[model samples]
Target: MAHMSILLLVISSLLLASTNAHDFIKYGYNGANGADKWGSLSSDFSLCSQGKQQSPININKNTTNYDSNLKQAPRNYVLTKATLINNGINIVLKYDQGAGNLTLDGKIYALTQMIWHSPSEHTIDGQSFPVELQLIHRSSDNHIAVVAILYQYGSPDAFLLQIQDELEQLAKDKCTDEQEARVPVGVVQTRALERRTRKFFRYVGSLTAPPCTEDVAWIILGKVREMTKAQAASLKAPLSAEYQSNARPAQPINGRTVQLYDELHNVKKAPSSKSD
Candidate 1:
């Protein structure tokens, strides 16, 4: 009995240490665990430093190749039940039964979640915007694709305005001791958030966050959308202080081809200077 008790104690200690190690592993947008240190944070995140093809690259209009063969993927988004949650890192809206799917390259990738980043991640001619909305989709084979929309401050976004109340409530809940800050946002119409543009930039890249998984299909809208300053603030209010400005710096293109898909087949002139 004594030997058995000692063996159990040893096993328990090892289990606790394993759990504690996992809990200690954390990443953030600033300070010690910032983007710069992400590569060394864990073995899983080594791709963040070593991957040849990463995301959020500045779309240099002059250098991008115009692919007439490329076309806008069909977006079939519908109203669906969603839950907004402050995932301790960023705000995410998870769909219960998936909002819809985007048909691209002969595959259907289901829209599963949406996330936001302030001060935008991807840049156009090296110019950043006030906000960025990312719609995440996954194919049946577990392939990932992201459609990113950049937003400039202007008239309020109707979709965001509809969820303003829930956002504020989430912000309030985050300040408490509640481990899970999630609210049922009822049925959300994703179509209302769609931008009316056929032009987009496409490339193969990695996930923006840790683990930094590569092979993600990125579709960045060529046209920048508009949203009110207040709406942008509401999106950031629920996140912790460190995450308020959560955007990883643009990664190197590393010889990857960026294809611009436009029906008109005209490349927009690159701005000489950065503007809002």
Candidate 2:
């Protein structure tokens, strides 16, 4: 049954991405043109407004139960030549080959690109984080698995500082084009899947963006990474002023259950504002 679920998910993702690629319009997160109006923007984005299993949900610890079937996806990231794009909304990191790959339940998904969302899209127990870094993966068949790491204001994260400096440079000229950069090997993957406890929440949800395709496996790491307030400001500096909150609001979970996988059995019952 576990294998079946993964297979079906992969197939669903492939079909959705292919069918919705052309019509996958870009929508913002504000009134009229924001998330509330995504579905009406185009017939293709009907899922955004209509899907019952949308992402960026508010996760409460009490709402989840342990699932023995869930397994940790191994991270094998290699140094890669990457590019940074402002894209008006958020800063996106695009990498050439040699980034990394995730092996989940025997299925391999290649790390394609990553991006940051300010003020976080997903929250823990209705509490927001400083930022959320999303590492996007695509299987050989194009199944999408998003690994999100929540960030809080605190001691600076070395990897984040590296990217932050590059983003700050981009902000100087307000460059939105894909500028050359190098992502050190394992820098992007190390802290994401490797937490102090290595736990995560898994769910079947749609993309937070347009077309809002469903059946995309969302693997949200329980660990909350930290960066200084200055680092947070540097990240937001590249984004446009209007893109203040690039995060999407928490959507309804509908009837779906969020499964938790605690490999180390050390997840705290009470969520802390910052990660250990």
In every candidate, how many clashes are there?
0, 2
Q: What's the C-alpha lDDT at position 270 in model 2?
A: 29
Of the candidates shown, which would achieve the greatest lDDT relative to the real structure? 1
Off by over 4 Å in 1: 1-24, 175-178, 266-276
> Which one wins on TM-score?
1
Model 1 lDDT per residue over 1-276, tens place = 999999999986664333122233577778899988988998767888999998778999999988877856878898889999887677888899968899889899999998899989999999999898999999999899999999999988887876889999999885433365899999998776553456788999988887788999999987787999889999989877877999999999999999988755545532423211
Task: Give lDDT tens digits, candidate 2, residues 149-187.
Answer: 899888888776556656667677454334322323223
Global lDDT scores for all candidate models: 0.82, 0.75
Model 1 residue 150 distance off true place after TM-score fit, in angstroms: 0.2
Candidate 2 global lDDT? 0.75
